[model samples]
Target: MSTYAIGDIQGCYEPFRRLLDKIHFDPVKDTLWIAGDLVNRGPGSLEVMRFLFSIRDSVIAVLGNHDLHLLGVAYANRKPGKQDTLTDILLADDREELLTWLRHLKIMHSDAKLGYAMTHAGIPPQWSLTEAAGYARELEAALRSDQFPVFLKDMYGNQPDCWHESLSGTDRLRIITNYFTRMRFCRADGTLDLITKDSANEAPEGFIPWFAHPHRKTVNDQILFGHWAALEGKTDTPQVYALDTGCVWGGQLTAMRLEDKQIFSCGCDDV
Candidate 1:
């Protein structure tokens, strides 16, 4: 059985399906690791959710920032943004089922046997793999609890841009969430620059792509992530893989086979 890690689908269901077909995916034998942003921005959010839900046993997914925003809108009564295309999901008959499944997805996933660790975005420089896993569990527990809506209400923000062991409550959760989902550029010391969405080379003066941080503890671990579509599936760092190819933005949908690292793609011009 093979394992494939796919980039953000972002509601581009047609392209996503085509890419899966291109890889000749076999649900019974193949395991699919999704890098997240499973819904939003593009068309077919409902279709994507339904398909993944049907194939839940063969799939492993993490949550992206857009996924969290959807949760906020659904549970926290936060309004959807003007550009969001999540209305279909919100209106679906199986909305609660889909959202509940999404809410339970882990923030980070790893397999020691596969020699890979994945999150929607890259892990912070300051976090050892063990620490990152622990923090992910903390946030995951809150999301799965009855107080999740309350946590969702406090989930949005850019404050406390750095990590500290002493940080508590919403502030700590928000920073941890940002590191796993919204992160792109951050300082060498692990302080996030959440505002910058430019390409890696255009990082603000004091920041660099999270994977590029010099002292990163996960440098020796194979890391798979998808948030920065600007990288178009390249990190130049041998141990870190960037999987998002901007399919929602009309670029190609991409997937990489874990065993051989062979890449597959499907154009999204009509997505």
Candidate 2:
């Protein structure tokens, strides 16, 4: 009856399965919290989505940037790039089923009893758990609505780089999405610096990893997140877990058992 939080799959189905096996996952008793990026840039996006969907009841996942990009390309007609590997999902017979399931997925998941929270990327330092949950709900509601295409259409961009209570319309939604799915580093003032892709050691001037901000509101909450594979599951800050090990980029797939905080990995063969 253990729970495991896994990093980004990014279509690396073989490694995903191997990691699950390494953990000796029992679907009937074990629950999985996925840190998102379940598809794209690997050879098995379609298979990965289908597998996750099949065991949907045993899993909880947040949306990652690549996941949203797949949605944008599917529903909003956003153009797929050369490296995009989501065509199989879009063209699958169960495409609607899979995408709809994905659209309804949470941007954040929390369990006070378990003392952990999950997001594709770190929650911004500005908001407390309650505020972050409310904002996540707001965006999730929009995504599940008929107006979702509007969100997908307006979802791109890094503008309005700071949070504000008064933000409305696409601007508000986009910023929230950015924080949940695309953020890595930010300034002390809560201004997001989305351009820096290096590890925390090389963080640019005036900016630091979101979890490292001294005033971060959710410091008491254990956060599980992906999207920054360069961290390689390393964040010196206590209780902040970086699970993405860049499996799609020739790194390993990683998972952590929640009860004992034990880590497991499987080498990826997708290179």
Candidate 3:
């Protein structure tokens, strides 16, 4: 019995499956915690989604930006771009089933037993693990609720700058979604800066990576995330693992065995 925490699949179904086979993952005895990006930007988005959908009960995933974008694009009646791989999914015979199952994924998963909090992107500096979980529930409820379309309708942007208690409507939804899905760098006071998506050297004058915030209280809990592919699978700390690895952008797909933190990765030959 094992629990495997995999990095962003990003629609790379072959690598995703090979990595699972390498670990000999058993749905009944072993569980999975995915960092998300289950679809988009890779060749097999539809197959990857269908495969995961078949085992939703055995898998736990935190929705990534690409995952949410797939939902929004589907609902908003948008078209997939040249680099987008979601057309395979949107045009699938079971598109409705796939999208519905995806919407059911939460944005965060934290286990005190495992001593880790897993999210698609890093959690905000202002949030403790407990608070992050609670806030995740708030958005998860909305995402799972009938009002989800309304929330998703206005879910994007960096407004409501800091966490404002009185934030309302789409503004509130955007703030919560951005923090959980798009957050990377923020100021010491915890205001998110979503515009700059670059390396540590270009972090502007005051912004810092979410993990580097001086007052962050989650240092005790290992934070596992999978955005910022430029990190090249480096979290810069043993306790923190950044697993994006650019699998969708022509890099290796990585997975970690949680009990002993043993890494299993497969190289990518095609983009």
Candidate 4:
């Protein structure tokens, strides 16, 4: 069975399906590792969720910033942003079922046997894979807990942009979530520049892309992530894959077959 890792769908269901077709995906024999941002921005958020839920057993999807925003708006009474196209999802009859599935999604996924790890954004430079995994579990626990709405209420913000082992309460959970969902450029010390959304070279002074950090702890391991669509599926670093090709922005949908590292793409003009 092949395992294919895909980039952010961002509610672009047609491109997602076409990319799957190009890869010849078999739900029963193949596994799909989605890098996140499963909903938002494009049309088809509800359809995407429903399809993924139907093939739940073969898919491993992590929660992205958009996914969390959907949850926050749904459960915490958070206001939807002006650019959001999540109204269909919010107004759907199966809204509860769809949101519940998204709520329970992981913050990170790893397979030592497959030699690959995935998160919505990317792992911070300061943390080892084990540490990142532990932090992922921590955030996942908060997301899946009864107090999830409470967590969502406090989930937004860019403060506490650096990691501290001593961090606790909402501060700890927010930073962990940011690292796994919204991260882009950061200092070697793992302090995130949460405001910048530009390409890799446009990073603010004193900062570098997370995977480009000179002393990155997990540099030797294969890591797959999305969220930085400006990257357009390119990172000069070996074994570190950026799969988000900006399908929602009229670019291509990308996927990497883990077994052989073969790349596949489908244009999103019709999306």
Q: By lDDT, is 2 or 4 better? A: 4
Worst 10 residues of 2 by lDDT: 262-271
Tens digits of per-residue lDDT for model 2 on 1-271? Answer: 9999999999999999988888889888899999989999999999999999999999999999999999999989899999999989988999999999999999999998898999999899989988999999999999999999989999999999999999999899999999999999998767999899999898988899999988889988899999999998899999999999988888989999999999998889732
What are the lDDT figures for the candidates, one per model? 0.93, 0.93, 0.82, 0.94
Model 3: per-residue Cα lDDT at residue 131: 83
TM-score between candidate 4 and the true structure = 0.98
- Winning model by lDDT: 4
Q: How many clashing residue pairs appear in each of the predictions shown?
A: 0, 0, 0, 0
lDDT of 4 by residue, 1-271 (tens): 9999999999998888988888889999999999999999999988899999999999999999999999999999999999999999999999999899899999999999999999999999999999999999999999889989999999999989999999999999999989999999999999999999999999999999999987899989999999999998999999899999999998988999999999999999743
* Weakest lDDT window of 10 consecutive positions for candidate 3: 76-85
Candidate 3: the clashing residue pairs are none
Candidate 1, residues 196-269: lDDT per residue as tens digits? 88898999998899999878998899999999988988888878999999998979889999999999999996
Between prediction 1 and prediction 3, which has the larger TM-score? 1
Residue 268 Cα positional deviation in candidate 3, in Å, after optimal superposition? 1.3
Report residue 270 deviation for candidate 2 (angstroms).
Answer: 9.6
Reference-based TM-score of each model: 0.98, 0.98, 0.94, 0.98
* Candidate 4 lDDT score at position 192: 93
